[model samples]
Target: MPDLITPTTRLYRAWLDAHAEWGPGTHEDGFGLTSTDDVGSRAGFASWVRRLGDESARTTCRWIIEDRQVLGGIALRHHLDEYVRWAGHVGFGVRPSARGRGLAGWALGRMLDHARLLGIEQLLLVCAADNMASATTIQRQGGVLEGIRDTPLGPARRYWITLTPPIG
Candidate 1:
C-alpha cells in the first residue's frame, strides 16, 4: 500500500507529469499543485503544504505514492465547508493513465480508515453527476448514495459513509 505523505517539492516534477497526463482543466482544489515552472510552482505549492496541519482550516492535502512515483492526490476535509454540507469528507483524483486500476477505491478506503480513527462518525462525499467512473469508485468503497443534490457546480451525487456504527 502506498503511503500518503507530506508534499515534497523534490517530487514536484514527477507529480506534474502525472497530473499533466490527466489532461487540462482537471485541476481540483485539493490537488495543491499548479503549472510547473521556475515561477511559483514550487513556492505556491510549498505554501499550500505549510497549511496541512492547520486545524482551523479543516482540510488536509496529501500525495499518494509508492516507489517514488506519484500516483495521485487524496484529501480529507474534516468538516463541511459553507457552500455544501454533503460535498465530501474526501476528494481524490488519479492520473488519467492510472485510472481503471482501482487506485481510487484503494485510496478512499485508506482515507476512510484515517477518518474513522479521527472519530468522524459520518463522512460525506460528492461527485459530479455525470462522472460515472467516480460514482463507481465510491460505490466500490461502500459509499451509500443519498441521491443527487444541487450545488453551485450543478447537480452532484451525494453519498455518506457511516464511520462509526450506530450504538449496539
Candidate 2:
C-alpha cells in the first residue's frame, strides 16, 4: 500500500463532505454518526485538521485508498485520563462509498504502526455491539475484548490491542 496517511488539506474537503452522509442505520442506534462532518461544521473540520497538524498531539491523519482519494481517516486523541477508560486511543471512519473494501482493516493496521511510533504500547478500540464490521476490523488487527460499557448513546464493546515486542 502506498502511504495511506497524509496531512488533511483543502484538497480533501470534497471527500469529507461525501463522507458525512454515511450515517447510522435505523436498526443500529449505537453506531453514532458515521462521518466526522456530523461532529462539526466545515470550519470545525478545518480547525480539527489544524489541531491534527500539531506535532505534540499528532491528532489526525487521512487514509487514501488505491484511488488516492480520502477514503477514510483515523483520529488519535491523546492526553486522556478518565476518558481513556471507555474511549479508545483512535477513532476511525471509512467513507460510505468506500465501505467493505478492506480499507478499515488496512487503515487500522497503519494506525497501529503510527501508535507504536508514538510510544503507545497498547491501544483501546471501542465499537458498537451491533457493528460486526467494526469488531471484525479490530479483531483482524489482533484486538482482545476487554469488556462492554453502557454509554448514553448505547452499549459499546471495548477491545485492547497490544503491540508485542518482536521475537528474536
Candidate 3:
C-alpha cells in the first residue's frame, strides 16, 4: 500500500533513487523543487528538506511511498500568488514508472482533506491541455471545468473543486 509522507532527509537514499529515475531538471512537481535547488549533495539535500519544513505554514508537500520507494509527490499551496494563480493550489507528478496506477487521484483526495482542514472552501487545479490523464484525475475528484488559459508553459485546462463541510 502506498502511504503519503512528509518530506524527510531520513529517506535520502530512497529519494535519490527516485530523483535519479526522474533524470534531471525540476520537473518533479509537488516537491517544491526549484532550478536553483541543489539536491545533489548530502548537505544540499538536507537543506532543501529543511526549507520545505520551513514553508509548512504556506504549503504542504507530501510524497507517495510504497515499500520504501518514492513513487510520486503532491503539494498544496495554501494561498494564491502569481505562480499559484497559474499553477493552481495543487501540483503533483507521478514518476514515469508509476503512471497508470491511480496514485495521482488517491493522493489528491487526501490533499483535499487537508485543504478542508485549512478552511479552504475551494481549490483550483490546472493541468496542461494535452495531459488527458491529469485532467481525468481532477475530474474524478469532482473538479468542474473552468476552461483553458494560456500560460508561460502553454495552454492549460483550469478546474475548480468546491469542498463541502465534513459530514457529521
Candidate 4:
C-alpha cells in the first residue's frame, strides 16, 4: 500500500490525463480527479487522501497499478449519507482506453481483498441502473442484487458482496 496518495504519483497523473478537460455537452467526469491546477493541486490531493477512513470518515480510495502503470482505481466508502445512500460502498473507474479487457473486474477483486482487511463483511456496490458494464463487473465479483432506489442522481442499483473468510 502507498504511504500516501498524491497527485504526483504516476497513477494520479495518468488518471488526470485519462479524464480531465471535458468539452461542452459531455457527461460529467465520474472519477472526480479533474481538479489538477493550483486550485486543486497535488498537495491538496495528498491532504484529502490522508484523511480517508478516519473516525466516521466517509471513504477510502486507492489506485490500481501494475508494472508501474495505473490501470484504474477503487474506493470503499464506510457508510451512506443522503447524498450517498443509494450508491452504497464501492465505486470505481478504469481508463477509457483500458476498458473491455476485464481490468475492472480484476481491480475490483483486488479491492475486495483489501475490503476484507478493512473488516468489511457485506460490501455494497452501486452503479447507475443503465451502467451494465459496472453491474457486470460487480456481479463477477460475487455481488448479488439487493435492490434499486431512486435518488437525486437518478436510479441506481445496489449489489451486496459478502466477504467470506479465506481457507485456513
lDDT by candidate, in order shown: 0.73, 0.64, 0.94, 0.63
lDDT of 2 by residue, 33-144 (tens): 2334332466755654565565335354555545456666666655455655566776776766778888788778877877776667878888888888999999999999
Q: 60 in model 4: Cα distance from truth in Å?
A: 3.0
Runs in model 3 with CA error above 4 Å?
Answer: none
Q: Given candidate 4, what's the lDDT at residue 34?
A: 34
- Compute each candidate's TM-score over C-alphas: 0.82, 0.75, 0.97, 0.72
- Candidate order by lDDT, decreasing, is 3, 1, 2, 4
* Model 1 TM-score (2 dp): 0.82
Best by lDDT: 3
What's the residue-level lDDT of 58 in candidate 2? 36
Rate residue 89 of model 1 by lDDT: 75
Q: Between which residue pairs do clashes occur in model 2?
A: none
| Cα distance off (Å), candidate 2, residue 106 | 0.4
Query: Which of candidates 3 and 4 reaches a greater lDDT?
Result: 3
Q: Who wins the TM-score comparison? A: 3
* Residue-level lDDT tens digits of model 1 in 94-126: 877767878778888878887776677887888
Cα lDDT tens digits, model 4, 1-168, are: 222232234355654455454322223222333333222467654554444324224566666655555556666676556545565777787766667988778767876886777677888788889999999999999999988877667998889899976545
C-alpha positional error of residue 117 in candidate 4 after TM-score superposition, expressed in Å: 1.6
Please provide, for model 3 over 1-168, each residue's C-alpha lDDT reduced to its tens digit, 9 standing for 90 to 100.
999999989888988888899999898888999988899999999999999999999999999999988999999999978888999999999998999999999999999999998989989999999999999999999999999999999999999999987656
The CA root-mean-square deviation of candidate 4, after full C-alpha superposition on the true structure, stands at: 4.6
